[model samples]
Target chain A: MGIGSDMYRQQILDHYKNPRNYGELEDADIEHVGENPMCGDTIKMFVRLDDDEETIEYVSFVGDGCAISQASASMLSNELQGRSLEAVRGMDRDDIIDMLGVELSPMRIKCAVLAEKVAQDGIKIHDGELDVEETTTE
Target chain B: MSQQAETLDVERIREEFPILEREFDGTQLVYLDNAATTQTPEPVVETITDYYRNYNANVHRGIHQLSQEASIAYEEAHDRVAEFIGADGREEVIFTKNTTESMNLVAYAWGLNELGPGDEVVLTEMEHHASLVTWQQIAKRTGAECKYIPITDEGRLDMEAAKELVTDDTEMVSVVHVSNTLGTINPVSELADIAHDHDAYITVDAAQSVPNRPVDVTEIDADFLAFSGHKMAGPTGIGVLYGKQHILEEMEPYLYGGDMILKVTFEDSKWNELPWKYEAGTPIICQGIALAAACDYLDDIGMERIERHEAELAAYAYERLTEEDDVEVYGPPADDRGGLVAFNLEGVHAHDLSSILNDSAVAIRAGDHCTQPLHDVLGTAASARASFYIYNTKDEIDRLVEAVHDARQLFA
Candidate 1:
């Protein structure tokens, strides 16, 4: 049986149908792209750093995937709009699924967290803390 | 219902497969992913169990009783596979790990030796990555150019394009006998004829064809054919690569080990006969024996009956899928295709539809079906496929239709 009807709540459906902060970003401080090759879900996250360079000034995402991936990216974009770069690294798969108010199957875990991966990757690249080879994957 | 039961006997056939009796989430499992791999029958399972329990010995190595028994059984497996597909003889069949390995065995052993720079290798866009990627690697290694035969919008092979593609420079023309993604049954016999006209050898990836339909290597006139055992009510890790005896005799051995060598020393070694030269090491002994049992099981049921049953189910699924306004079906009409229906619902991703379908205990395959080129051609990222088998019933189709409605309600 399915996990629960709670997974497909109207709010989650709303985010998927009318995604928030959707589209590419120009003059972005950090841009990261990620994909779950298994299902061909491609997600890109762009973060514009505020003048202080500690907090996220604006966040935008672009992706083509299942509802869970798209909705998670949409909902997460709103959460990261003004958060610090520190909070982005602290976020994991559970936090994303928890925010969605649903449980994701193991096979779909990659989809729900692809946006968060891109955001954190963007943070690492922005700080110049990540190796170029490492940033190329995950 | 009772009248139609006489023709299919699905209930009786279901009993042969123990997995069909299983339940998921308090509901009977409706397995619609037969095209990926068919569930093994009790007889095939028992045959494998008997092999290990009774005669568990490495074939062609020992002169002991267990070795003799294992060798006999394994040889019988080759004989059964040969007869199953109307191969010239037992020597034509070579056991490999799976269909992928079978395809690679030809690419490495045959294609690498024959194809070179300035040569063209013709393939269909509808090939699974197993068949397509190997040719790509061959092209890279041999400096051969790989060309594709275009598929029509409706998923049928465009013969006109194929005529242009398979020119005199083409040395090998490889194609899938049946497309795993779009369910289109290709005209391989005619393709083989075209390849022969160009003086090129043809290889048929029959992994999707031999299971549900009657396939004869002789009738198709294929120089090489490959199919997996798991897809035909047998075990995994057991596959067959059938080549014309003369072609196999001339090709270099793909692997080197004890069983494949007639005489080995520090200086040099001579290879064994036609089939054994390709099968290195101990090989999949038990799975091969069970594969013979699977062939026997299919023979008892009759390939013609299975083909008819699958065609009917495919037609029904197509009819039901087309009735929904939001569903855009893929592949040719049921009469022209095999026993599978692939489609996409409006605003529903294939994975999402499959996740929801699982709630109803209906199993299906979602995603590109390993034909990324075909998926790109179809303008769909992924599609949901429901493939039928001998054990599938109309009741399962009804449940699948209901599951689609539920998916549409949730997503669309």
Candidate 2:
């Protein structure tokens, strides 16, 4: 496969094969779930916040989906372990694509952003500022 | 393969579908997405364009000659389609937008009016969302309980489970005749018998079966049968919903407008006759004619031979796909399947597989196939499906195998 191919990039396959921070955290402070209704791909993100209440202490996730979705979740959870929740929630689609290290077709873009979304959703739920039902990101 | 060729002139059949001759990239297009929608042959296409060129007018409302001709053509479609499905008469066929609309018509028009809190509407897990979600919504509306007859490991409907599921509490049973995802052909006649024993009506979502197999509404003793026109070589925007005459008479109309009313007053309106009562407004005028043409085309080719041809294709495809390493195929045994195979290769997302296949000029469907619960049961988010049709060939199936091989080498 060509390196330039948006779908078969080395970084994507790497994360897909060896997804980091997979499984659930027992003492998680925030847990949120998100689903792609059209594809039936679901991801549940778990996060334990630091004493500061903003920085991520530890994070994990569990889900079954396409490489973009699974790999994107793995990479996102791993990246968030040392970052602040505000920094991640402030991230736009471009930031998530940058984290993915691969370009995505418009249709697959949601897969790349799903993890970022669930993390944000988790933070919102932790703060009691969001409705779990209303905020289940598509 | 040779035996299949003898029964169907594959080359001649391929020529009739204009899109079959086109090339994608450097490779000729090998379309196997027939379960989604079949490529319309030239005759059906011509029938549509011919209607627009010759008789362009609103049906039933106008008193002019154009309306008369359009009305005649549209009603002829009713006769041809009714005969094709073995309905009692032309009055049994009501034209709708697609099979989804037909299902909704039954749910809103019949289920809402007839069902109640204690009623149980039996369904199968193998149903597409068009069949499942409608009943689910109806259940929510009428306070009925929606029960499903789960599929066996081989993906066929569990008849043993079905026997237990359709009991006295069951009020109506809606099931898919041929599963779009699993490729299982359900025995509707048997299911209908069980439902009737409980004083329940059965509705068959024949979206996948009607175009590929021989369907007889009379033989199946169906209360309602629904199938889309586009899946059977006809134009889009038209579908057929066949209900037994008396049952349709009992149910109310779905949409209200121009042609469906017998008499209209400022206060209220009286509905029209049997099939017309169900069809409101100026329907898919040209599409109805084209669907009739499609029915005629399938008839001339002989449906039994078509069934044999597709069964052979499914068997061949299942074998070829299974031969590849890292691939997992889902569905019943070859003989029991209708005309498709759903599969996914290890380490490759079904969508990724679809994109990879597209590079080699092959077309296949990749998604949940609108059966999310089944996908949940299969423990996958989605799967790839390659469904066969009359014009598809063995070489094309080989191309599909090669594409999967490429995907395995790259992704797996």
Candidate 3:
């Protein structure tokens, strides 16, 4: 409505409008939920791991949240499919930020990264690397 | 409404807030999240510093002069808050952690005991989590049904639905005086009348209302009210819960031990007075004093003037935002709406829009704003909000419009 048409990229809105990999994973080996509380952005992430507990056979998410969070979740599910749990554990904040393809304020950085955090937490729980009680606020 | 009225000396007011002096993103810090929490003024900061520095003794327990001074300051803050909200007496105001805890106190102490099976607790869809979830928990515990009045397309409460929902089974009606997300100023007085007709007490969540407007508990005839100090330029970790004297006396204490007891012998203990009985453990003395200072500051500026100023600004923001072809605004398009705007760009996500605005040093809130039920009703998971306060200016609104235009461009 103002200047460049690049702001509302079709790819971004397309993923948001009709998100792929946007439902619950039945009998998930690991699951975790995180909420922003202030903004009311909630996310529940699910992970199905290989028998050896090294690779993520199937990853999915189901929750009601903002478009940014939903799209990010969709993107993460697609990226993390067939990827090993250890590879995602090695991923840093900068990697997730870069994947979003947009700048994020400190406050909103959480919204964009919330799904990743939950996914990592779920992975950690599955691998027995960390206890399920240890909640990460990433 | 004319814009020719003398503008508030925002520069002078800006100087009073130390946080405003800090630079952000190579620009002057422009904080638009007043609805979340206001920056503390120097006077209030100094009051807190002086209390912790000089009078650092536990109040109501020590006999030293420092303790006496601290106790007096704490009690004076209670009195100030009681007078600020036009309560019947100081005993009516009980200090809690914040508005959430204050409302929880009412729900656990009042709701758990008074409500039972077949009882109904009426609330509106526009309530914050603090107001909504507490009632939900109470309903779960007491087997009482939780009913909500739906919101209209313009984000106003549907009074027709409210009338239908409120019946003889309605035990209590807790509604927000002003919606934080939509900025719709609810008709609490009229709602109170409806609740009273059913012989039910009403509790008003004044978190958004008290900070922006003048609220008289007696005039509204609210049996209980909850608000936070931080929302009104006061310190965090402190809030006030105002309950009718008789109702408070009848309810059980929320917490146990410490100053809340009159006499204890390990067998049977008598609870203290109306306000003190509910306030257990060590109180937030310094924050309470700062809250009193904030009350004085608002009283000096005049709440009516602040409300009128915000109304004008809200109307101006609504008008300008609507001009953008892609912008979809939520809430009632009325001058009487509170000084907040929740909207969404055509294509960009609210978080992305908020992030881009941050790049331009234009602070705004983006999300469900802790009113998930209302957002669900509005058919969106999140929205970007630009809220106005005493320090905000029309020029800032212009900046916001331009920045939103920039955000739209970035995503386009």
Candidate 4:
């Protein structure tokens, strides 16, 4: 009556349980914190970029959140580690959603993608390139 | 206890709520989110419909027959609500948008005047954001200190901590009668006594308690009590703030507008009497009438019986859910608790669990439940909550158990 056992694949649990690269990066050039007050999920993304902002020197995350959010942060931190700041900032919602390796409902999508969005926002804010107005959820 | 429980016809009472008749997917609509808001009954809906169709008019100002009828109906609803909570008089019941607004009214009007630099407003760590944030803003405005009575790991409020925090300098003690997240009902009557002894006022956020249990403002000895109509099977956008008459007379009007003014002068306007002074502009007439109908519905069912029924249901839910190998339930597993269970599955995140449950057409709240501080204390960012009301039944609980087992299998 439900999805197959592959839905709870061991790899997913492993990533969720012992999330990779889950901590703050010291001497980071950019930092952003996003919070879901509805679920009390807090994610902090730290990015340390090299001079000229062409390469990502380091990236790490520290957050108190659900397993999906933590795992998403872990995956995001790993994916952005060697990528350029421009590449990281250019990542869209679908790129991060696909990285999660599981389907997310509309409501849970925000929780899964919050870390990636925060990273992009942090980079934009730090690079003095933030031009868009903040979006308010009803 | 068994004989007393037998007096209430559970099945008959469940028939009153129309939502119980509907089916969700293949299963019956097992609404366990009553603490969030109860399902409105036919009578309450009819009351609103009747008002809008027949006698919908601006209240307190009209001399026409329909307008007078509407005005009377609105005031009568106030009287009904006032009596339901054992308030001193209908004049003490001020209508606001919801419990949040009611709390803000007290915070802005009363607390702003009484609370100042070096003064303290004591609150519990278990309060919802509505109660906690209002006082926090008040503290920020007055340079007053906001102290908290911490809860133990078991979700019980520490009286020793409360005693230490509530002192001569404490001007107000605002606490939730029942925690919406944990479902732990506090001993507010005793707390009110303690607050009064210290010459401090007590305000209770009865948003969770009023619907499930019988609340008497006089018995609790509360200076002010606030609850939302939506939570009690009434329409939304309407709430009641029950203040002691003398205390209400002392506070300034919350908003300046028509119906709240007694004598209008450009320089200064005198405010109207007790409840009307606080109710600025046009009231939620239909919502208030619906709220009165809701009050009548609950009263007819008897609150004590409803409380016992929910306690039994909660106990059943706790025992059944905890029987699973990997589930962790929050709050005390006692008859004293309200009919709410906040829990987590070992391998599944709460949002995932809720989504799966939604797929099965089961409606349960999956989030912080609006008590972030309490969630922090529980050591979880989110939890799946199943809260019960009059419409819920043991069969629904059984279905929930089956669905939960099925949900875990998805994670497995």
* Model 1 TM-score, 2 decimals: 0.96
Give candidate 1 regions above 4 Å deviation: A4-6, A129-138, B1-6
Q: Write the per-residue lDDT of candidate 3 for residues B223-317, one digit (tens) a residue.
A: 99999999898999999999999999999998997999999996899999878999898888888888999999988877887898899889999
The CAPRI-style docking tier of model 1 reads medium
lDDT of each: 0.88, 0.88, 0.84, 0.83
TM-score for each of the candidates: 0.96, 0.92, 0.84, 0.89
Interface RMSD of 2: 3.9
Once fitted onto the true fold, the runs of candidate 3 whose alpha carbons sit more than 4 angstroms away are A1-138, B1-7
- Give the per-prediction TM-score of chain B: 0.98, 0.98, 0.97, 0.97
User: Residue-wise lDDT of candidate 4 within B272-326, one digit each (tens)?
Assistant: 8878999889988899888999999999888988888889888999889888879
The alpha-carbon lDDT assigned to residue B305 of candidate 2 equals 85
Q: List the residue pairs that clash in candidate 1.
A: none
Candidate 1, B1-412: lDDT as tens digits: 3546336677888889888878877888899999899999999989988888899998887899999999999988899899999997789999998999999999999889998999999999899999899999999999999999998888889999999999999999999998888889999999999999999999999998999889999999999999999999999899999999999998999988878888888999999986889988888889998999999999888888888899899999999999999999998986777899999998888888888888888999998888887888888778899999999998899999999999888876
Q: Model 3 Cα displacement at B186 (Å)?
A: 1.0
- What TM-score, to 2 decimals, does candidate 4 have? 0.89
lDDT of 2 by residue, B1-412 (tens): 4665448888889889889877855578899999989999888888888889988899887899999999999988999999999998888999999999999999999999989998999999988899899999989989999999998898989999999999999989999999999899899999999999999999999999999889999999999999999999988899989999999988888889878999999999999997899888778889999999999999999898899899999999998888876889999987779899999998787987887787787889999999988888888879999999999988999999999888787775
Q: Give the number of the best model, judged by DockQ.
A: 1
- The positional error of residue B144 in candidate 2, measured at the CA in angstroms, is 2.2
